[model samples]
Each structure stands twice: as structure tokens, then as C-alpha cells.
Target: MAEASLLAASIAVLVGTVAILVNRVRTPAWVRDAQLTLNASAVTSLLLLVCGALLVALVLAFGIFLLATRHGVVGRAMVCLAATGIAHLGVTVRRH
Candidate 1:
């Protein structure tokens, strides 16, 4: 179950990673405004993205911890949640 949980989490994160990598230019939307308004200033957008990414990273780390501790269900849930966040972070017009 733990292995399966890790697999699912990795897959979820991979999907978002692919979405981000597929873009040749830019994601256009950062973490703040998923609608791609681009209303935030350059620095502001960058900051928001950075902050959001950090938050996601923290969640991902926690998910990892849960997995290590053999909390399969919670780990899977947290990891999936983090992956959705990252996907939205990359895909645009969506929020985690």
C-alpha cells in the first residue's frame, strides 16, 4: 500500500511536470491568478509563484513523511492534493 501510494503521488506530480515542460514559452499564469489575468506585476507574479511553489513543496514533503511513516491513505491524499496544486501552478486558469 505504501509503495502504491508513492507510485500514485509520483504519477500525479509527473503529470503536472509534463504539463509544465510541454510549454515552450511560459506558463503565463503564476500561482496568484490562475485565470491568466497577469494583473500582478512581474516581481509580484514571480513572488506569488515562488510562494505557492514553496507551499506545495512543503505539502509534498509532508506527504512524503506520511508515506515514510506508513500512513498510506493520508499520504496518498496529501500527495494528490499537492500534485493538483502543482498542475494548476503550471497549466494556467486553475487553482489547487
Candidate 2:
């Protein structure tokens, strides 16, 4: 579980970095005062991407650990759920 959490945290950091780059690329000048919309979108996207990555990574790590210890059902479920979350994030990123 602890290892899982660490993996999740790493994923979040990676996603956050990507988000920052995306924002930098999309944001434009001269709309500074009313750039609230862009700002909000960037923040929300960043958060969502990071959270999704974290959840997926954590579940995946947990599932792998369980498998290593020969815990079947629990391990499988975690892996499935993690894959689902990761897939969702992949779709979201592609859409944007």
C-alpha cells in the first residue's frame, strides 16, 4: 500500500508538469485581466490529470504487490480499476 501511494504521488508530479507545459503553450497575452476562464481551465485540467494519474498508479502498484504475494482476487480488482482510471485519463488528454 505504501509503495502504491508513492507510485501515485510520482504520477501526480508527472502529470502536473505536463499540465504546466500545456498551460504555457495555450495561454495568450492581452487578455490578462479577464484571463480567468483560461486560468480556471488550466487549473482544473491540471488537477484532474494529476488526480487521475495518481489514482491509477496507486491502484496498479497495489495490485502488483498483491500479485507478488499471491493474493489473487484483490490484486486483480485493483489492477483492473487502475487500468480503467488510466484509460480515462488517456482519453481525456487526447480530447484536449
Candidate 3:
């Protein structure tokens, strides 16, 4: 269980790092516009909003996964949930 959790966290970090790199290489139009037009405070608030939405989405995805899998693997599910939170925090920190 500990190994599974560690693996999930590692994968999440890798995914988050790749996402950040990709985003840096090719920013979306809306994000670019927001960065350009918004002040620091506004941008921070927007980031928070985006993070919140992402967290909700992650929770919903995990919930659906649990339902589909019949909740047979609680450890794996919990690891995934933790990974999602960690990845979100990583991206948020990178942005800041």
C-alpha cells in the first residue's frame, strides 16, 4: 500500500511537471490573455478559481472511478486522490 501510494505520487509529479513544461511551451490563448490583462492580485484569484475547479473535477473523476470499480481497491483509489491533490498543488506552486 505504501509502495502504491509512493508510485502514484511519483506519477502525479511527473505528469504535473510535463504539464507545466508543455504549458510553458504553448500557452493557451485565454491564459495568455489573462496574464497580460490581469494584475497580480487578479491573476492570483483566477489561479485559485482554476485550481478549485480542477480539484472538484479530480474528486468527481475519482468518485466515478470508484463506482465503476465497485470500490474494490480502496488503497489505489485513495492514492489516486492524494496524487490529484499533490499534482494540483505542484502546478499551483509552479505558477506562483
State the TM-score for model 1: 0.57
Q: Report lDDT (Cα) of residue 59, candidate 2.
A: 87
TM-score of each: 0.57, 0.56, 0.35
Q: Which pairs of residues clash in candidate 1, taking residues 3 or more apart in a chain or in different chains?
A: none
The lDDT-based order of candidates, best leading, equals 1, 2, 3
What digit string (tens of lDDT, one per residue) describes model 1 on residues 1-96? 776766677776767666664562254444444434555456666677888899889999999999899987778777877877776576432332
Clashing pairs in 2: none
Whole-model lDDT values for every prediction: 0.68, 0.67, 0.60
lDDT per residue for candidate 3 within 1-96, as digits (tens), equals 865565567567757766775576366774566455444686676787677767756765775676578663554555456555656555445454
Residue 3, model 1: lDDT of 66
Model 1 misplaced regions, further than 4 Å: 1-36, 92-96
| True-vs-predicted CA distance for residue 74, candidate 1, Å | 0.3
Q: Per-residue lDDT of 38-82 in model 2, one digit per residue for the tens?
A: 356887878878988988898899989998898765676667667
Superposition error at 8 for model 1 (Å): 13
